[model samples]
Target chain A: MRSPGSRLRATITSYLLILPAGAFLSVVFLYSLARLGYISVHNGNTGLEGPAQIDAYRFIVDDPLFRQAVKHNLLLLLSVPVVTVLALTIAFVLHEGIRGWRLYRTIVFVPYMLAIPVLGTTFVYLLSLNGMLNSLLQTIGLGSLRQDWLGDPSYVLGSIATIIIYHELGFGVVLFLARLLSLPEEVDQAGRIDGCTWWQLRLRITLPQMRSVIMAFVTLELITMLSWVFAYVYSTTHGGPNFASSVLELYIFNDAFSFQAPSFAAAAAILLLAATTVLIAIQVKRTSVEVNPE
Target chain B: MHGVSKGARRGWLLALALLASAALAACGGSSDTPATSGGGTTSGGKVELTFWYWGEDDAPGANGWLASAVKAYETANPNVSITVVPQATDTFTATFATAAAAKSGPDIAAQWATGPVLTQVWNGAITAISDLVPADETKHWLNTSENTYNGKIWAMPEYLIGVPWVGNKTVLAQAGISTLPTTWPELIADCTALRAKGVTPFAFGNDTYWTTQLMLQSLSSVDDVVQASIGKKSYTAPEFADFEKGWAQMASAKCFNDDVSSVPMSKGTEQFAGGKAAMTIGTDGNVRAWAKTLGEANIMLGKWPTYGSGPLKDYYNATQSTSYFVTSWSKHQKESAAFLVFLHSAEQINAWYAATGTPPADDRFDTTKITGAIDKQLYSFNTTGPQVWLQNFFPPQVDGNGNAPAQQLVLGGQGDAAAAATTRETAAAQWRAQKPDEVKNWSNFHPGG
Candidate 1:
């Protein structure tokens, strides 16, 4: 049996090895978070010169813009399922070894490799009222399908979600495909030997095995829908056409930078961070919800 | 006089950098920065002053003029070195705010006049120009009253710009309209006349929201805007709310472009530049730009139609476009002040007008030196009377959240004037709820006093 002293020594060694990365994270992330928390309550001055209160929180609660932003974030959550299904279908098809599977894989992952700003700027022009998207629709005799893709309030958020899905699809596909390729070939052979149809086999066996990977993807995407959509929205619409596409991050940005109201922005940011923590917590404990079809 | 040509180059990297910069607004960060106005120099006696400016988008040759001016100033004062950094419209306020929080930024920075400048001053970001520049010199500066707070001028005016209704005479004649609008009823009749000829009238972009300046014609003074923002008065009142009806009427009359909400302000002006539309409201610099594009003879400049019975209704919409100010933390405040004073000298004044074709904000500049008839008219518009840029009087929050969105509501065909008024009132209440100290500061603010 391992001695208690030896175990303690090993634990200390592990901690010592982790110290650099842990310290780095604490300085970069935790420090910023603490500073953000301070800015939230404290009024703008040389720090403690002014009274610190929850005035920022009160302001955000009553702000119709803030409410609209939160609503848009919730609406974007609907895109998570659509992204997962699309990624899974693409990954599944490529894993099946279609004739151009290698080439298709390369094409699928290319967008993920492109810088997000480049994609956003390109799509903004392509989606404008007189942009190439509408022109192409006209040429293809699909003129009726052309709407004000980035202009209309009713459609702007959906358009942003669509852009994000297009950009994010490649990352999800590559991750799922990597997992599928690592699985045992014997498992598929056994399914075929049992006279299982391709569809039935995927539904009964393949999907069940993918639960862990799927969980990881869904979690990342949930966090993404919550925190990482600022670039897409800012570059394209700047949370505009009357804050129709405003997200929590953009609201924080405007409150901080544009409106000269960083106190309010800091308040919104702390709320966002707390919500993100709850998301990570849910993902970590997801083992309890795991299902076994067998 | 805000000429912001905010381009679309932002992405994840940009936002991440901004967030990182924002974190520097921490209480801990300010103490370590150049918060104190220490000496500006290296080991030698030479002084380097950094000037952050924004103008090229509105005034085409401003960058070139600045480069020449910098070179000239350096040659004249051998011991002084100047570095000029241009600012973008979208990032201007945020960049300055980030610098302000750290208490370390430019020796000299340019700002949009009045509210944008005073907001920073209230943040303790600026050193009052009255303390830096001599009274005799500052007395000659036009529109100095706009930047004055508590009887001290916080910033120096550089150039004058006015919001003029720019019409393409060729396009107007094509629509069978020879005269431009001077009153609300006449403007509506003109919109109908242009629509009958299948010409789009009153082209506007609402995403950036400055076009709402037209609504300012309904109010008499900056105090009215201040009172509404602090909840002393309702935005739903007839004086503050009535102009929204004009926007609603314009929207219903199909006065704006079909995609007004989606496009940037640049795109909205592009339609006018391309002669695809009849008229747009633009700065004096924009008037010069349009004159170049559509030929000087094809351009007509006039006041925004009289929309309300307020005393300011007939006031010409012209004022200083941007202000030059020394940072409170600037080490070379004296040298910075010297450079600002040189900007108003007769040589620099003539050079400024020659290069940019926009009027320099100095009373000493001879009006006869202005060549173009349009230039002469724009200048006259600026000097005519007490023009109210109602947007400037609004807190940045109310301008962005209330006035901006309310205009977008009408342009998108989503709401009426009443709804726009309610939106403005809600934004004012939101501001008051968030910033008690600012509310107090605004209450102390008497524009006339």
Candidate 2:
């Protein structure tokens, strides 16, 4: 309805308003991604004197450590379902106003508030051969089951995953609880009035409504399990007991910092990012298919 | 139209105010640098120097000594302001690397002797000390050859770090062994005697890879490995297999603590300190700490047991602990060099002894000044014995990532020594392939000087 001149002027003004945000994204996001890409192909050099060594990728592909790290990352993915189900169950119980729900919520959230490094360190001591856990196990006559918790390669990754789940459960519980509490009371009342059992109400009514939120959380859990487990691994296991519990991030750290081969580190990082993207895409596609049912 | 002109006048004044504010902020940021970098004004302008170091964990009183030294240096040279940054032991190298890669950091930085220092030098992060210190002065320092790269000294050597087997006389006597074993067969027999008395023979933790490194050093000579790394000798040769046999024997003999891989290096040392182990091998600083509990008279430092009666049995796996280097990016090189030289002065030398309870790297350091029973043994071992540390010869990738875990595998009974030796050779080959220049310029130190 406006004149052509005014419409053009308004469009220009709108672009101008967005210019600062666009410029910030370009520098912080796009620039960092471009730098990472360049370093992936270039040889590792602290100074700007080295030539491009595209074969850095080949070195990563041939590395046994890199392969082991990938395998560990995939193995850690198994913990995602365990964490989600535990979180959802607790969230549902709290939403139903179970006895001591407030105390339970507070207790569950306390771990998420604590720092990961400190928690991981405390757990490392607890899980050691002569630690409290083993001592208690011995006291309780379960000494036969006690093993080298952090040292044994068979149990190291699983130990780290358990620590991560303990730390992350609170965040998941609080998140799912917030969504469950926000559901309309009328819908719940209708389901109950229709003679649905508690489990049926949760399964047929409440769970169906939580599909999107659950999917979002599952996606988040997938991403975090894959990438954000470095601190726990570093502080506790150090990817040790003969690389039994090594992860992609630990490999990146060792290659980049300890080994001083940032080029190879960059290549591994890029490959991990690509793999993560593919996984996330597949998850999203599956979620979409479930939603549309086409 | 008059009202619009008045509003535009207000906008112009606001813009000018903001510009002035930003300029003032920029000036304020620049002024804060006097504390960290550029020296504050004194009689003439003072030249501020920043020195970074780490080792509070290994050497107990190092940080306190540094603080006192800085105060003394500042009082002596009023025109110089020195700030000492105490770094943590774990991430010091990585943090320094990040700063070096950015071409900016403290004027002085801490480094390990050869391997770590050479890596930084290759990256152009450090300036050669030869450019700063006089040749006459540098010639008096011990282990200068380790830091020599491309025909120049790249770092200033600090105190010696030696891993010698320290025997607990009380524990040994409990097992009916009065004499310390000097040969391989004798040591194994001693281990059997200790185990019969329900005492752990060699208390070790594989998490930090110290025990594994010691075993590796004992089994093979440094020069042989260096030659193998450079393609002059084959790592798959008979000598390399000695490592596998030695480690497999130790593991099978139950010579180590039951929780070897579970605990860290510190914990294993504690086992020896608690008198649960008859013998343990660790650095001199660690030996000193153990002496506090076990009594100086009760502990005796000796060479690692002879490995299959080789000439290298006389060689000691000793190397300098942490060294210091001036940054290539430092603007006050002359002042920094002066501070570094001042550290070697006789007054600072005494301070080093009083503070660290360890001998200084200065050759002029009088061995007679060391009077403690443990201190005397360490001094004798360092001064009289041959020097070679396996870690100093290999790159971090080969030593840390590859050899450390491979050794753990051998200790854990998952893999044999042959497999570990082969794995280590493969890692060294990768290093040689990737860093051909490093291999080409590698120095193979000899035994017995």
Candidate 3:
């Protein structure tokens, strides 16, 4: 058995190694989370910490805007699977060494590298009622498909999703491609020698190995759909056309800044944090199983 | 105010003490008295002031004017250095609230007049200008009443703005129209004629309820909006919401652009400014900006077509819409106030009008310097009437949650005027529940015509 002093020294060394990240987390994440929780229970809108109460939580839950914003965020989560499938297909095709695969990969990845505000602004213009997109559709003799992409409430969410998917697809593809390339070359050789069809080889061999990465990516994207869409909604619609495009993040911003209801904003933020943390925990559990399976 | 961080919460007890002191000062201070030694310089004999300014959205040349004004002031007073931080239109008040909650920030800041300013005053986030500025200097400041709180001037007015009804005579001529509409019935008829002529009747953007200001044309005073807001009266009442019927009618008549619900204020209004639409509502500065592009002779400046019989219906909705004030925590309160005073100097006053063509919110601004026919008429309409812009009176929550969405419903072809009114009523009820402090404090504010 290790001596008490030696055990204590090892413990101290481990903690010392993690001290920087621990301090960073304490200052940045934990502090902000704690502050958010504290602010949620207070009536700061009237005065600073007027009273600690559940009024903010109760009020936000009853708000129609909050509900609508939550619904919009849920709808955005639908894009997660669509992006994953598209990314997987592209990655598989590129993995097969299709002609000009590098160029195709570059084209797919270029969008993710572009700035969000620039993309959002360009998309807003392209998707406006009389924007370039509709004009192009009209010129291409697909005039029947022309619709107000950003202006119409029914289409605004979908337009935002399309922009997000376009931007995020590259990251997913690159991630899967990295994993695909790293898998032992001998596995592919053995599968081919066993007379496995190309589709079967990829579906049976390549797919199962990426289970953890896929789960991790999906969880990350779900979190993104929940909270990272503020920039997209803000730049394009500002949660307008009668807030048909409002998301939870935009709702929080509106309450905190525009509406002067910080308590409500904090409450909403805490709800978002709770949801994201649960998702992260689930992802951690699933990936841990993959790492140390029985 | 929003954005009270945890770091800010630690200062609440101290802030409450400061609030008590501010309340004491409000009760006892005179306009001529200097409440604190704010003009004090540091040991290095240098006074630095950070000014958070807004209104460049309404006044395009304001940024340029402020830069020149700052340079001149720094040259004249070598001991003081000033930094102008232009505030974003979307987060103007929130950023300030975050700073105020922290109890340290810009020495000077701008906020919308009355309801927005008074909320800050109650929170003890600002210093009353009457304490920092002299009675003689502020006596010349017109519309100081807009920022008055507990018998002290809480904020300083810089310029007056009115939403003037602007028409393109050339565009109107295309529809065989000679006179701009002056009544509700006439506006409908003209809209029909304009529509028949393949022209957009009134270019407006309702994306954020900015167009809802026109609904205030029916309310008589600030108290009317206040009463409706606090549930003493209903927002659904005929007098309060009747204007929305005209808007709904206008929308049904297809008087606005098809994209009215989707576009922002600048884009929708630019359709008029760029000569694509016939008429629109605009600030005096916007009126001047449009005139430059659409040609001076082609522009028609007038009041909103009459709809309500309220006392303020015929009067122009004109006042100091936004103003600057010194922050409570600023050490350079005196130097900041000094800069504000210099802004109203005769040279600066003339320069303001000349550069902006917007009438300065001071009594000393010479009116004759206004040469444009539209400018002269705008000045007369502003000065000769009771000026009450209703949007400035309501809490911003009601503006964002109630009026904006209600207007959005009608414009988007989703709901009728009654539905719109009910939306406002619901928003008001919610705000009253959320903010009882503001509602209780409103008893002290009796704004009159």
Scanning candidate 1 chain B in windows of ten residues, the lowest lDDT window is B1-10
What total of clashing residue pairs does each candidate reach? Answer: 1, 1, 2
Clashing pairs in 1: B1-B321
Computed on C-alpha atoms, the DockQ of candidate 3 is: 0.23
* lDDT for B379 (candidate 3): 84
| Candidate 3 interface RMSD, angstroms, 1 decimal | 15.2
Candidate closest to the true structure, highest TM-score: 1
**DockQ values, each candidate:** 0.31, 0.22, 0.23
User: Candidate 2: which pairs clash?
Assistant: B244-B417
Q: Is candidate 2 or candidate 3 better by lDDT?
A: 3
Model 3, position B353, has a per-residue lDDT of 78
Residue-level lDDT of model 2, residues B228-271, one tens digit each, is 66767765676665656776788888888877777777876688
- In model 2 chain B, which range of ten residues has the least summed lDDT? B24-33
Indicate the worst ten consecutive residues by lDDT in candidate 2 chain A: A45-54
| Global lDDT of model 3 | 0.80
